[model samples]
Target: MGEVLSIKSILGQEEPEHMNDSMSEVDDDSRPPEKCPHCGKALKYKKFAIGHFTFGSHLEKCDCSGAEAEREREMREKERLQQEEEARKRMKRIEELFRQSRLGLRFREKTFENYKIMPHNKKAFQTTLEYARNFAKYKEKGEGIFITGDYGTGKTHLAAAITNYLLGKYTPVIMGNVTKLLGNIKRTYDDSQYTETEILKELYTVDLLVIDDLGKEKPTAWVEEKLYTVINERYENYRPIVVTSNLELEEIEQRLENCGGAIVSRIIEMCMGVKIKGPDFRKQKLEKGRDV
Candidate 1:
C-alpha cells in the first residue's frame, strides 16, 4: 500500500508540470488566424522567440497574384503623393521668383494668345512664338532673340509675351525697361534696400533676362559701362537675354560706340535678330479715333 501511494504522488506532480508547459504554448499562439481578402487563402503566422522564451507571433505575407497587385497599387499611390509634394515645392519657388522679377503690371497681361497677327508682323510674331515655345532649347544654348524695329511696332509686346509665357512655365525670368532697370541700379548708390552688387548678381544669374527698349536709354558713359557689365557677364556665363530696341543693330552699335562696340558684338553673337516692320498700333488707334 505504501508503494502504491508513492507512485500516485509522482504521477500527480508530473501531470501538472506537463499541463503547465502546454498552457505556455497556447499563450504564445497569440496571433489570430487570418485570411487573405483578395485570394481567400489562409494567412500564415510566424512565431518570434528568444532562446526558451516566446515573445509574440506576427502575420506573414501572402504569396499570391492578388497580393502582388495590392502591393503595387499601394506603391503607386505613395509615389504619386511624393510627386505631388515635389510639384507643390516647385510652384512655390516659381511664385517667389516671379515676385522678385519686377515684371510690371502693364506687361502682366501680355501673352502669345492675345498677340494680333498681321501680314506685316506675321513673321516677327511667328519667330517670337517659336522662341518662347522652344525656350528650353534656346536657354540651354544661351541663345536669345534680338527684336529690332520701329517704335510702337510691337517689339516690347513680343518681349513681354515671352516673359509671361516663361513665367507660366515656372521659369525664372526678368523683364524690365532698360532705362528703368538702370535707374533702379543707380538709385542703390544712395540709401536703398539693395546694393549695386546684389542687384547685378540677380540680373546676372537669372534664367532669362529681357531688356525692353534697349537703345532708348540715354547714351552716357555710366550707362554703357553698366550695360557692358551685364551683357559681358551673361555672355561669359552662357546665360540668355532677350532684347527689344527701336533702333537697328547699326544704330545700336553707334549709340553705344563708347563701350567700344563690345555690347553690340556680344548681342550679335548670342542673339538671333528678328526685325519687325509695321505701322505703329498706338498711332493707328489715335488716327482712327480722330476720324471717328
Candidate 2:
C-alpha cells in the first residue's frame, strides 16, 4: 500500500522477458500422462504443466518418493529465505541513503500534464521542459534544474518525481533540504574530528544532487565558500546540481553581497534556471476545497 512497495509491485509485474521463453514454454503434448510421481495416483496434465514449469519435471505431485518430496520442499524453502534476505538488504541500503542525506522524495510516475505548468512563466516553463527532454534524448544525461517559484508551487514535487524515476532506473542520486544540508556541512566544519574536507568530498562527488529550497539558509562566510566550492566542483566535473528556490536569482545574488560577482556568474553558468509563476499551489487547492 505504501508508495515504494506499490512501485515495486508495479515494476515486478513488468519484468523483462529475459528468460528463454521458448525453452521454458511446454509443448502441447510434452506432458507425461502417467500416474502422479509420488503416490502413484492418476496424473493431471494441466497441474503437471504448471508444476513442471515452476518446480521442474521431477516434482510430480504424488508420484515421487517421500524422500524426494522432502528434499524438494527444503530446497524451495531455502530459496525463498535467500530471496527475502536479499530484498531486506536492498531496502536497508535505500533507507541508509535516505537517512544520511539531506533530501529525499520520490514518485513512481510523473508527467507534464500531471504537474500542470504554472501561468506566470507558462511559456518559459513549457519551453524549458521541451529543452530538457531534448537534452535528455541526445546526451543521455541529466541536467541541473534551477527552479524559481513562489512557495507551494509544484516545483519540489516535479523534481522529486524526476529523482524517483532516476533512482528506480538505478542511476546515482542524492536529495536533501537546503538548510539542513548547509547546517550539516557547517557543523561538520566546526567539529575537529569530522573534517569538512571529508564530508565535502562525498557531496561534491555525487552523481546528482538536488538542493531543495536553495535560498532558505542564512549565508555565512564559510557557507558561501563551501557553496561556491561545491558549485564550481560539480560544474567542472560535469555532475548536475538541481536547485529549487522560493527567491529569484537577483534576490539570491543580493543576499550574497560580498561573495563577489564571479562566483554568482559561475553559479549561473552551471545552472539552467527557470522561473515559475502562478497562484500558490496550496492556496489554489484550498480554494477548490481539495485535499492536498
Candidate 3:
C-alpha cells in the first residue's frame, strides 16, 4: 500500500520520497518562456535554480506603442534641429553678401530716417522719398530723376539718401560730383594705374548713379563728349541716373550747347525733373554760427 502522507510532510515541514523528482521538473531549462498578453511576443525568462525563475515583458513589441512613439519623437527632434541649422546658414549668407557689397561706404551717414524735411521743400522731399521707396519699380521701368535748385538746397542730401537706401537693399549705387568724376577720368590718363574704359564701365553698370553738381564742370567739347558717352550708354542700357544741380533746365541746356541738344534730350527723356526750393541750408548754418 502507498505510504500515508502526514500534515507536516504536505506543508513541507518534512521532505517526502518524491520531492527530488518535483524540484527537478520545476527548474527544467527547456521550459517555455512567458509571452506578452497583447502581441503574443516571447517575454524574457531565466531559471536561477530548482523551482526558481524570473520573467519580464518587452513592451516595445507589445500593444503599448512605446517603440513607435519614441521613434516619432526622435524624428521630430531631428527635423527641428535641421530647420534651425538652415536658418543660421541663411542669416550668415545674407551678412556675407552685405559685407562684400561695400555699396554705401561714402553715404553711410546719409539715410531717409535722418533727413531734415522742411515745409518749403516738402514736395521735393516727398517725391524723392517715394522714388527711393519704390526703387524696384523704377529700376524695372528704367526711370531716372533730375533734381535742380539753388545752391545748398538739400539737393545732395536727398540724392545721397536715395543712394544709401538702394545700397542698404543690396542694390549697386555709384555717386560723386560730376567735376570730381571728370577729374578722376583725367587722372587715369596720366597714371596708367587706372583706365578710362574701366572707370566708365563701372559708372554705366551700376544699378543707380547720382551725378551731383552737373553744371559745375566747364562743358568743353571733350567734356561734352565724355558726359555724352556716360549718359548715352546708361540711356541705351535702360539704367537709372539721378542728377543734382544748382542750374535750371534752360541753364543746363545752354551750358551743354556743344552737344547740340543731344545731351539735354537724353537727360529729359530718362529723368523726371523736380525743382527743390528752400533757403540754403549752408547759409542757415552760417547764420546760426554768427549768432552763437
Candidate 4:
C-alpha cells in the first residue's frame, strides 16, 4: 500500500541516527561537506557508490580504497571479460548455424576446373576435390589439405577447388592473399567497425577461412595481431582454416613474430605442416621433353 522497505533497511535507518555521525552534522544550510555519513570525513574528492541491500543508504561517500576498488575492479573486469568472451563465442555459434548460399558470382567463380582434369594428377586432384565438395562432411571431420607447391602450380586450383566444394555445404569459403587480408583487417581495426573482440570472433567464426601465402604480408603490429587473432582463435576453437604457404611454420614464425608466440603455437598445433614436394608445376608443365 505504501513504499515498502525491507527489514534490514528498516533497522539500518533506525540506526543511521546513532551510527552515521556525518548525518548528525547536517543542518538546513551547512551539510557534511559531501562526506561519508558513516565515517565523519569526505572521501578524497571522487566518490564511488554501489548498491548494498543490507545497508539502507541509497548513496554513501566511499573512501575509494585502492585494494577494495582493485578487488571490485578485478571482479568487474572478470565479469566483463567473461561477457566479452561469451559474445565472441556467440558470434561463432551464429556463424556455425548459418547457411549462406553461394552467390552466382561465388558459385560460378572460375577455378582450375578450366584446366583439363588430367590422368597422372587427375585422380589425386579429383579425390581432393571430392573432399572439398563434402565441406560439412570433412570440415566437421577436420580433414582438409595444405594445397601447395611452386608458382603456377595447382595451388590456387586446389585452394579454389576446396572453396567451391564447401560453397554448396551452406558454409562458403573466402579466398584472398595473406597481405590483403592483413591490410583489410588492419583497416577494420583503424575504422573501429570490427572491434578487436569482433575481429577475433570473425576470424574463426566462419565455415571455412583461407589465408594463402602466410609470409607474404607486410610486417606491422596491427597485421600481426589480426593474423594471430584470426589464426590463433581458429586453432583454439578447432575451426577449419586452409593455409597455403611457400614458407613453412618455422619460417612463418621467424618472419612474423608480430603474430605472437601463443598464436603461432596454436597455428602449429592445428596445421600438420604439409610440404608439397615437387618441382615447380609451371616449370614441369613448360618443359618440352620432360619425361615422366
Best by TM-score: 1
lDDT of 1 by residue, 1-292 (tens): 4533354465553333322222122233456668999888887666643223343466767889999899999999999888667656654654443344466677888788998889989999999999999998998899999998898789988999998888777677778777766776877888777778877887787888999888877889998999899989999998999999888888888888698388989999999999998899999989999999
Q: Please say which candidate is ahead in lDDT: 3 or 4.
A: 3
Query: Residue 43, candidate 1: how far off, in angstroms?
Result: 12
Instruction: Output the better candidate (2/4) by TM-score.
Output: 2
Compose the digit string of candidate 2's lDDT tens values, residues 113-216. 46675457566556545644444441234347688889987677666655655554444556667566656566764664456665576567655677877667
Better of 1 and 2 by TM-score: 1
| Top model number, lDDT | 1
Specify the poorest-scoring 10-residue window by lDDT in model 4: 21-30
TM-score of each: 0.70, 0.56, 0.63, 0.52
Off by over 4 Å in 4: 1-112, 115-127, 141-143, 189-200, 258-264, 272-274, 278-292
Per-model C-alpha lDDT, please?
A: 0.79, 0.61, 0.73, 0.56
Global Cα lDDT for candidate 2: 0.61
TM-score of 4: 0.52
For each candidate in turn, give its C-alpha RMSD to the true structure in angstroms: 13.4, 15.4, 20.7, 17.2
lDDT of 3 by residue, 79-108 (tens): 988866765664444333323333345556
TM-score of 3: 0.63
lDDT of 3 at 143: 89
For residue 45, model 2's alpha carbon misses the true position, in angstroms, by 39
